[model samples]
Target: MSTASPHLQGSQSVATGPKSHPRLEIRNIHRYFDGRAVVDDVSLQIQAGQVTCLLGPSGCGKSTTLRMIAGVEMQDSGEIYVDGKLICDTMFRVPPERREIGLMFQDFALFPHLSVADNVAFGLKGSKDEKRLRVEELLQKVSLTRFIDDYPHQLSGGEQQRVALARALAPRPRIMLMDEPFSGLDNRLRDGIRDETLTLLKEEDTAVLLVTHEPEEAMRMADEIALMRGGKIVQQGAPYNVYTRPSDKASVAFFSDINVLKSQVNGALADTPFGQFLAPGIADRTDVDIVFRPQHVRIDFDRAGKGPLPTATDGVPARAVVKRARYLGHESLVEFQMDYDGSVLKVTVPRVFLPEVGRVMWLTVPRNRCFVFPA
Candidate 1:
């Protein structure tokens, strides 16, 4: 098997809609189980034809939030709006079927006895001619027109997911809620399916709120990402913004492997093995973590115990001995034992670079890439 590249936005480009009126708006939503807040004060907005992903780890309340929006679970507090009209709140409620919202679950949930066309047309309310026309159109859009009469069991996992998508869209819903809809598909098929599904949703002019625990999935499918943790949004932004300008050290580590150096703040600077880091907004004498991703760490040969000249971008080099190296197909991960404190640091290089375990090298982390946070 071959290694896959990271998923990014624009794998399937489509026309973007104006944000004059959000198709779906969730305001300060909260849900509790046994006095513990499971979905706490979550708020987001998704414009028509836009995809926003609620990204977090498992049990972080992403699915629960989606369920509340779908009307399967009611929020203890907060409001849900569609097209700027209040649809759900503590005092008022709207049934799931009446909300004009479509949902696609991870399992697809297709009826075993129903044909593809019938499944798509199941909830549709129209004349026989209208229902058939809508189902046929969706089938064509999903490129499953030839299997219109096939049952769910006869289709592959990816095909079943497409059929599920068609069914969710057949009613021309104003909003779509998807909960890890592509997780069941094989990894090789996931990227292609996500691109195709996103294209279809955009063309249909539906606002999409997708829930996924995978950061790569969020980056691939979301026009915007709401990074959730412990039932609250920690950060929300475009994939690039969230990935590059993280709010904290944990945020930086969430996207990829991180190398951390523990240090103490004296005055306004934190001294680490690599170099001194500007620790603004932090109190004096406080401990801080100097965080940088592996890719930002540059490794060079140790020539006569001296290394590359220090610059504004690349900080002063620190001596380290290679402990272990592993090739991860597309990239290589090397672990180094820092000579400063005998601590281990991991670095990821775009290309393969493996040296003897005991070899000594100089490592310098780019100053711009390091994020200083309170430890």
Candidate 2:
């Protein structure tokens, strides 16, 4: 949120501190397979002590971009730089093992035959005492010092993950690449481990690029999120900015359930059941979509078959018949059929508020909460 120098180009957005080199930077990275581009012109910058999530659905090139940055998979084009020094490009390359980059995947990948301390010390260099000291320090940081002599088979899934993290950090890598590293843990353990891992990574001041398809995970872990789709980043910014001010309808839908109202633009305005929405630059007769999340729809009791009067902020209320209602843990979701067009719309209310099917209610949407996009 506190960006020093912000730059925007097409769909890509990057913010960097002034007069400081980013710990990891990739420019126009492309990767192809079977004559199809798996990664296309992907670019991002991660500063030290920052976590940037490359977030998207499956097969959206998030993993490929991470692999390219880790130096395990070469990009077809583009350049990789660390501290303003070029590490990889079309003509030069840095081997994965020599790149000083740490990698953690869904699988712990620790050797069952080796002790925990030995596994962590595998990447360290120095005398026996120094290596042991480094391993002990990392184990303590991960809160596994007591299990230093235990093998991977002796540890639980979460313990094994902590060991893997310790092993990756023992070498003091400047950059850490994580590919759905918490996917293996159960929901109960996943949250705790994620927080712990984040704290450890930040303490080490490592630039982390995490690849995740889960929007919740990205929002929870990322200092900045680069939303990827079809091998390209469509939006990149702080989690709040990316969510509150999306680039398009698809971007909005990616974060949560969305309800769309379709209308034709006339005189820079689109008429909906609630009221007219301002479509500033849209041409007359052009089709447009008014998109808003379910939570933004306000519900009120209907009196004598009439709804609330129109207001400047919230437009006129419209009558809707309840089609169904389900109580989700944190909120109640109610689906409704509009009296105006019979179109279905969903609204979410906090806590348990379940109305019987066929019950009538009035709904109003705040004009400012809606997004008008060309259809």
Candidate 3:
């Protein structure tokens, strides 16, 4: 939903920029409950007009980190800053409302009794006319001007979410913290609403910290992704870098299905049924896990009961019998039983290609596509 700038009115100057100070910054954040750490030493910086997503599975402390930044929950140890000014510490703190931050949760927490306009203008600080103008401007920006007088109960789920977004942006908060804000909507509705929400946030130029378990959501909305697990951020970077160059097998598996080959390191190399992977710097006798995604596997048809010749890229060809094949909508998944040890490997091809069970094929993994890690 592209619209004119709502933050500017006639002579009022619109603040658009990467401000000198970060809009929000958390340093060495840690939160604990009952002697157990839920958020352990997490830190991130979000500049003005940028979106940073806290991405991970449920119970990975993403929500806790967002809550701490929102001033609803204080970090047991660490400092929270806004505009380079300290807003909260273990003892000192600002209240949630005074933090100049907005929050949108999964439930769309709209006031059912209040009209849409009133709900949007609830937190806005100005004269009556100014508040009404701000509400109208936001409603129009979100394409909900026609329903301004209706109550929350009368609006659809997507409309209610739009209202919530309008409310959050009406106050022009410096930073917005969202916890799975679109999870309640259907898949189709979620995508449209997410795009609209992102547009509004960009127009308003407020930093956003979104918490979600879905990897696709983070990839769509985040300028930077912070992947969390077990109460710590294991990886943080652009979505492409995080997806293509993962720090560990779990990081790779988080984005897609992976095939793992477990082996013991002997003389800095781990030998597997497929081939040997160079595990440099690994201690002798240490267990290592060689991992690759299904798409990285190349399949060759067995002709005359023979396989393709070996090459440097695909070091060795491992012959396997087709165990099962499934034709997905856009691609096909084929599982194979390796001849060396009968271990199973999965490969995905672009279009429909189905082979009967017990048919033999050669599976070769490109060395560059494989990630070697300690098991």
* Highest-scoring model, lDDT: 2
The TM-score obtained by model 3 is 0.92
Output the TM-score of candidate 2.
0.95
Worst 10 residues of 1 by lDDT: 1-10
TM-score of each: 0.95, 0.95, 0.92
Q: Put down candidate 1 lDDT per residue, 1-375, tens digits, no spaces.
A: 111111112233333466466889999999999999999999998888889999988999999999999999999999999989999999999999999999999999999999998999999998999999999999999999999999999999999999999999999999999999998999999999999999999999899999998899999888998999999998888887788767777678788888888888898788877778887667889878888788879999999989888876776899999999999999999999999999999989989888989999999987767777788
| Distance from true location, Cα of 328 in model 1, Å | 0.9
Of the candidates numbered 2 and 3, which has the greater lDDT value?
Answer: 2
Order the candidate numbers by TM-score, best to worst: 2, 1, 3
Residue range with the least summed lDDT across 10 consecutive positions in model 3:
1-10
* lDDT (Cα) of model 1: 0.88
Off by over 4 Å in 1: 1-19
Global Cα RMSD, each model: 5.3, 4.2, 8.5
Please write out the lDDT profile of model 3 over residues 1-375, one tens digit for every residue.
111112111222123354487889899999999999999999998888888889999999999999899887889999999999999998899889899999999998998889999999997888999999999999999999999999999999999999999998888899999999999998889999999999989889899999999999999998888999999999888877677667888888999999988888898778876667777777889877888899989999998888888886787888899999999999999999999887889899999989999998998988877877788
- lDDT, model 3, position 246: 79
Model 1's TM-score against the true structure: 0.95
